[model samples]
Target: MSAPSRIVPLLAEGVLAVEGTAAPSLSAGAAQPLPAPGRYLVEPLPEAPLTVTLDERSVTIRPGGWSGELGPSRGGRVTGRARDDLDPGRDVTVLALATGGVVARATARAADGGRFTLDLPATVARAPYRTRLTIGIAGSDHVLGRVDAGRPPRAWGPAPEAPRLRIKISTPNLREAPLWGDSHFAASLAAAFERLGRPVGVDCMDAWYGRTAPEDAVLVIRGRQPVQLDPGKINLMWLISHPDRVEDAEYAQYDRVFVASDIYAAHLKDRGLPHVEVLHQATDAVLFGGVAPPETRRSAPVFVGNSRREYRTMVKWCVEQGVPLDLYGGGWDGVLPPGYLRAPSVANRDLPALYAAHGLLLNDHWDSMRDNGFLSNRLFDGSATGTPILTDPVAGLEAVFGDTIATASEPEAFAEIIRSCLDDPTPFLARAARAREIVLGAHTFDHRAATLAAAVDRIAAG
Candidate 1:
């Protein structure tokens, strides 16, 4: 027996099909028809046509069509098809841009095989100009393609009158802040040079020495690392407030040298360096502020530092003395005792808030031989936050903060100081407030920048 003649819907109402040789038909008055053998390209009216596939089991309908390529200029184009099987009435769109700005757009109907074209502006080969191109589908919001053009060169001028001062600190990475040290010192120094309208660059001393030239002045902060320098070039070096490194010949090449403390100055003088100056470190108030006296006294005390050495000792003492202590910083591992809070590593922006949350902040010195020249960044952070500090009796600590900071000669003495603060919190709060005022006035980035600028001027004169 011959197979029954089958029929399929020619196209949905209002849908136009692209001309093809093999097309399916459907039986009269049938709710559904058998599978169609050939492909029928169709465009729906008023909207992009949705394409439908018919098979033995089911009928599948999907929205829109493949994207098509636009022509290429300096920019290129993408093109594809669209479908709206159910509606049989839809419009398609093309979007384009040039110079990063929108240049043109085109809308077309899918009825005539859904073909469309978009043109892009030509690329400019000259410098000192800008070029960009982008294309997206209309109505659907899907981006088709993108292109970029040339950018014009920026104008240049003569270098500034102020000297270019490059300061170097010895550390592995520029991103890591010094533990138990003030990162603001380097940042403030850079800011200081900026305020004087001088060109300044700060980086690791080892890195700076790698790029050192006759024109570059080098300021080494507690840097024990070796640096290669050119002898004939005018170079200035400052040891800052740090211990003397064994690498004296490396430091001796600089034209002028400075030390922050008398002890450090004497050590450099003993090494017979030329034009050594003793300049005490100063702080900037503008960068670090918002530390006001607390409204009510609280017994909560906190300490921040790496859990390397003397931290366990300090924590043990605080616990033994029945004090509520909180700690923020890493390296604790299994070292922390019960009742101590471990705060996540604080960011520079959030440091002020962290300090303000506590009543007192403790500063501990490393006990190794390297500790001699080390000064705590916590000193400045505490001062900036107006948190009363109970620090170790380091030589420079008193000079840096004066009588504003309470010093502890020993672990027992440190515990006693905390006890007294807990007993009469008013004096501690007063001391913390005073400390903030002192740092703001003298120990800020602005002040350091000026100092650096003046030093640079003097070096240039000689």
Candidate 2:
């Protein structure tokens, strides 16, 4: 018999929950957080159950169970020109594979002119690290074509005479959109390089399988692990989430390694990682300007981040203290107590307005980020938006953000910070204004861009 189906709230922690029932145990980082309202995960029931709606975005079980989240926006897009001989009326399917695993699959009818586009789930974008594309008929298994579609956009703008420098950035894909919030370092850094009078190309780790940078390009790799690239002038911007685990041998291939924080750079330098430098995360002024209107401004404390031990501690403390905290990000649903308001993930572009609307923004870094004194990009983003923040204390935070951003070392201290921020707005607003000036003056993406250009120029000169 086919298994029965039940509606469950899907959480980032991988717990499956039915109404009025406890969630099953979830594994670390493998599970997604509890989805907010209007979202559901479909699970099989013990007994056979009739499914009434088996649509792509939702599934409904008879005897009253329904589950599913909204489908991906327009599916994963696959755009390629069709062959002149191919039938425009027939449907086509595009499949993305990584290490022989079906990562993303989508189907769409050919447009009138033989140009085809298919949208698959966004999860398909992250995968076996190498991108191999296969096109086949929608229903039949017959494969029609295969190609390694892993090229970064060849053109940034009109080509310059003897392109000054071609930098290919390799970073984890933050999100599908190229916005500052969901940036794959390549995209934002590309814009920065363009402003500095150099053309650049950007590629994410997922789509760069078996890919080699053009002979004339410099590969700027920024991620935890090493991405395979040919031997060249590689500048490794290592954002360490786990400093203790980083092996010097893994990074030996790169010529220079850039850490996001001074403390981290010092740590790696002491450990004998060659050519270590500091390149802190910063905010983009255009994206994070404190310009939200007065009517939409908020006064409550807002926390936006995914789960970690620190997050669990802070969120629980806030709940027990009866602090009216607003939570956003994934992996909290299964773990967090119900009735505490939870919001879906916010886009990077929307975060400035969101921060501007609130009186206080809460931040806590990853263990490595905190231990090694690496700053969270959210810090600069909040500061640039002129939003007051109460974050856990880090070694070098005060030196960079100064008194503009408050620090709370303990859970009790975090609670008190929330209470005080809400109890009176006067001092907090003043601090936020000061923080905005500091960010605008020395901590914007423009500043980072200049730093990046100078670093590259120095390397080229040497």
Q: Could you say which candidate leads in lDDT?
A: 2
lDDT of 1 by residue, 1-462 (tens): 543322122232222121222233222211221112222223222243333323322222222443444344443333444333334366665555432224556664668555555544344323235443345554332334444444544222332565566766655455655442435567667776776677677765325534544354556665533333433334666555434333454444566666655556666687776677766565445545754545754577787666664446667677777777887777776766766856746665656666677777877655522245445556776787788888766666666677898877666777778878878877987888888887877776676667666776665655
lDDT of 1: 0.55
Tens digits of per-residue lDDT, candidate 2, 1-462, equal: 543332332221111223322232221222122222222222222123222222122322222121111112222455554321334465544444333234455554345443455554444443333244444332222233433333233223333332344443333343643432324344555676677676666655444444455533355444433344434333444453455544454455565677778887887788777787787777777777646635544657888876743446567778877777778877776677776556758766677888878878888777777888988888888888877888888778887878889987777778788888877877987998898888889876677767766665555555
Give me the displacement of residue 331 in model 2, in angstroms.
Answer: 2.6
**Candidate 2 TM-score versus the reference:** 0.60
Q: What is the lDDT for 24 in model 2?
A: 27
* Number of backbone collisions per candidate: 48, 15
Model 2 whole-model lDDT (C-alpha atoms)? 0.56
Q: Give the true-structure RMSD of model 2.
A: 16.9
lDDT, candidate 2, at 442: 86
The per-prediction CA RMSD against the true structure, in angstroms, equals 24.2, 16.9
